[model samples]
Target: MLSIIYYFVFNIFIGDYIKYSCIVPADASFQVYRDNFIFFVKVFYYFRYFLFCFIIVIRLFYVKNKFFRWLIKKICYFA
Candidate 1:
Protein backbone atom coordinates (compact mmCIF):
# COMPACT_ATOMS: atom_id res chain seq x y z
CA MET A 1 0.00 0.00 0.00
CA LEU A 2 2.80 2.38 0.82
CA SER A 3 4.53 1.65 -2.44
CA ILE A 4 1.32 2.18 -4.36
CA ILE A 5 0.79 5.51 -2.66
CA TYR A 6 4.35 6.54 -3.37
CA TYR A 7 3.99 5.58 -6.99
CA PHE A 8 0.92 7.78 -7.34
CA VAL A 9 2.50 10.66 -5.49
CA PHE A 10 5.63 10.71 -7.61
CA ASN A 11 4.17 9.77 -10.95
CA ILE A 12 0.98 11.80 -10.88
CA PHE A 13 1.13 14.53 -8.26
CA ILE A 14 4.74 15.59 -8.30
CA GLY A 15 5.13 15.29 -12.04
CA ASP A 16 2.11 17.50 -12.72
CA TYR A 17 3.11 19.97 -10.03
CA ILE A 18 6.48 20.46 -11.65
CA LYS A 19 5.05 20.60 -15.16
CA TYR A 20 2.37 23.16 -14.33
CA SER A 21 4.70 25.26 -12.25
CA CYS A 22 7.22 25.51 -15.07
CA ILE A 23 5.13 25.41 -18.21
CA VAL A 24 2.17 27.54 -17.09
CA PRO A 25 4.26 30.59 -16.18
CA ALA A 26 6.25 30.27 -19.36
CA ASP A 27 3.05 30.11 -21.37
CA ALA A 28 1.67 33.14 -19.57
CA SER A 29 4.81 35.11 -20.20
CA PHE A 30 4.63 34.24 -23.86
CA GLN A 31 1.05 35.41 -23.95
CA VAL A 32 2.06 38.72 -22.40
CA TYR A 33 4.64 39.14 -25.14
CA ARG A 34 2.05 38.64 -27.84
CA ASP A 35 4.63 39.24 -30.54
CA ASN A 36 6.53 36.18 -29.33
CA PHE A 37 3.52 33.87 -29.40
CA ILE A 38 4.86 31.55 -32.04
CA PHE A 39 3.41 28.35 -33.45
CA PHE A 40 5.24 26.24 -30.93
CA VAL A 41 3.88 28.21 -27.99
CA LYS A 42 0.33 27.93 -29.35
CA VAL A 43 0.79 24.20 -29.76
CA PHE A 44 2.18 23.94 -26.26
CA TYR A 45 -0.83 25.76 -24.80
CA TYR A 46 -3.35 23.42 -26.44
CA PHE A 47 -1.22 20.41 -25.68
CA ARG A 48 -1.15 21.28 -21.99
CA TYR A 49 -4.94 21.24 -21.74
CA PHE A 50 -5.11 18.08 -23.79
CA LEU A 51 -2.52 16.42 -21.59
CA PHE A 52 -4.37 17.39 -18.43
CA CYS A 53 -7.58 15.83 -19.72
CA PHE A 54 -5.71 12.77 -20.91
CA ILE A 55 -4.05 12.28 -17.54
CA ILE A 56 -7.35 12.40 -15.70
CA VAL A 57 -8.85 9.81 -18.01
CA ILE A 58 -5.79 7.61 -17.88
CA ARG A 59 -5.64 7.77 -14.10
CA LEU A 60 -9.26 6.70 -13.83
CA PHE A 61 -8.38 3.41 -15.50
CA TYR A 62 -4.82 2.74 -14.40
CA VAL A 63 -4.63 3.89 -10.79
CA LYS A 64 -5.11 0.89 -8.51
CA ASN A 65 -6.31 2.21 -5.18
CA LYS A 66 -9.71 0.73 -4.30
CA PHE A 67 -11.15 4.01 -3.06
CA PHE A 68 -10.12 5.82 -6.22
CA ARG A 69 -11.57 3.01 -8.27
CA TRP A 70 -14.90 3.36 -6.54
CA LEU A 71 -14.84 7.12 -6.98
CA ILE A 72 -14.07 6.75 -10.67
CA LYS A 73 -16.89 4.31 -11.10
CA LYS A 74 -19.28 6.70 -9.43
CA ILE A 75 -18.11 9.58 -11.62
CA CYS A 76 -18.45 7.51 -14.74
CA TYR A 77 -21.89 6.34 -13.75
CA PHE A 78 -23.03 9.88 -13.10
CA ALA A 79 -21.52 11.13 -16.29
Candidate 2:
Protein backbone atom coordinates (compact mmCIF):
# COMPACT_ATOMS: atom_id res chain seq x y z
CA MET A 1 0.00 0.00 0.00
CA LEU A 2 2.79 2.43 0.90
CA SER A 3 4.70 1.50 -2.26
CA ILE A 4 1.59 2.15 -4.32
CA ILE A 5 1.26 5.56 -2.76
CA TYR A 6 4.87 6.34 -3.49
CA TYR A 7 4.44 5.19 -7.08
CA PHE A 8 1.46 7.48 -7.50
CA VAL A 9 3.38 10.39 -6.05
CA PHE A 10 6.33 9.73 -8.37
CA ASN A 11 3.98 9.38 -11.35
CA ILE A 12 2.36 12.71 -10.63
CA PHE A 13 5.71 14.41 -10.24
CA ILE A 14 7.07 12.90 -13.45
CA GLY A 15 3.95 13.84 -15.39
CA ASP A 16 4.19 17.43 -14.22
CA TYR A 17 7.88 17.52 -15.04
CA ILE A 18 7.34 16.32 -18.61
CA LYS A 19 4.37 18.58 -19.15
CA TYR A 20 6.17 21.72 -17.96
CA SER A 21 9.55 20.88 -19.43
CA CYS A 22 8.11 20.41 -22.88
CA ILE A 23 5.92 23.50 -22.72
CA VAL A 24 8.32 25.90 -21.01
CA PRO A 25 11.25 25.63 -23.41
CA ALA A 26 10.88 27.81 -26.51
CA ASP A 27 14.17 27.17 -28.27
CA ALA A 28 15.25 24.59 -30.82
CA SER A 29 17.77 23.43 -28.28
CA PHE A 30 15.00 21.87 -26.26
CA GLN A 31 13.97 19.78 -29.26
CA VAL A 32 17.52 18.81 -29.76
CA TYR A 33 17.69 17.89 -26.09
CA ARG A 34 14.68 15.64 -26.43
CA ASP A 35 15.79 14.10 -29.69
CA ASN A 36 19.24 13.26 -28.37
CA PHE A 37 17.84 10.82 -25.87
CA ILE A 38 15.78 7.63 -26.13
CA PHE A 39 12.61 7.34 -24.04
CA PHE A 40 14.09 5.36 -21.15
CA VAL A 41 17.06 7.68 -20.98
CA LYS A 42 14.74 10.65 -20.72
CA VAL A 43 12.89 9.02 -17.83
CA PHE A 44 16.18 8.17 -16.14
CA TYR A 45 17.38 11.74 -16.55
CA TYR A 46 14.27 13.07 -14.85
CA PHE A 47 14.61 10.88 -11.76
CA ARG A 48 16.77 13.47 -10.01
CA TYR A 49 14.11 16.09 -10.62
CA PHE A 50 11.62 13.72 -9.03
CA LEU A 51 13.88 13.33 -5.99
CA PHE A 52 14.14 17.13 -5.79
CA CYS A 53 10.36 17.39 -5.87
CA PHE A 54 10.02 14.71 -3.19
CA ILE A 55 12.37 16.63 -0.93
CA ILE A 56 10.44 19.84 -1.47
CA VAL A 57 7.16 18.09 -0.64
CA ILE A 58 8.63 16.67 2.55
CA ARG A 59 10.06 20.03 3.58
CA LEU A 60 6.78 21.81 2.95
CA PHE A 61 4.85 19.17 4.87
CA TYR A 62 7.29 19.34 7.75
CA VAL A 63 6.91 23.10 7.92
CA LYS A 64 3.12 23.03 7.71
CA ASN A 65 2.34 20.39 10.33
CA LYS A 66 2.97 20.68 14.05
CA PHE A 67 1.99 17.05 14.57
CA PHE A 68 4.69 15.85 12.19
CA ARG A 69 7.23 18.00 14.00
CA TRP A 70 6.24 16.60 17.35
CA LEU A 71 6.31 13.06 16.02
CA ILE A 72 9.78 13.50 14.66
CA LYS A 73 10.95 15.00 17.91
CA LYS A 74 9.55 12.10 19.91
CA ILE A 75 11.10 9.55 17.57
CA CYS A 76 14.47 11.20 17.90
CA TYR A 77 14.16 11.51 21.66
CA PHE A 78 13.26 7.86 22.03
CA ALA A 79 15.91 6.67 19.61
Quote the lDDT for 59 in model 2. 76
Against the true structure, whose TM-score is highest?
Answer: 1
lDDT by residue for model 2 (1-79), tens: 8557666766666566555665646577777766544364557557757876766656756686888877766765897
Root-mean-square deviation of every model: 9.6, 10.2
lDDT of 1 at 78: 100
Please provide, for model 1 over 1-79, each residue's C-alpha lDDT reduced to its tens digit, 9 standing for 90 to 100: 8557656755676555545544444565566554343444455545656766767777777878888888888888999
Error of 2 at 59 (Å): 32
Runs with alpha carbons beyond 4 Å of true place in candidate 1: 1-48
- Per-model TM values vs. the true structure: 0.35, 0.31
Alpha-carbon runs more than 4 Å astray in model 2: 36-79
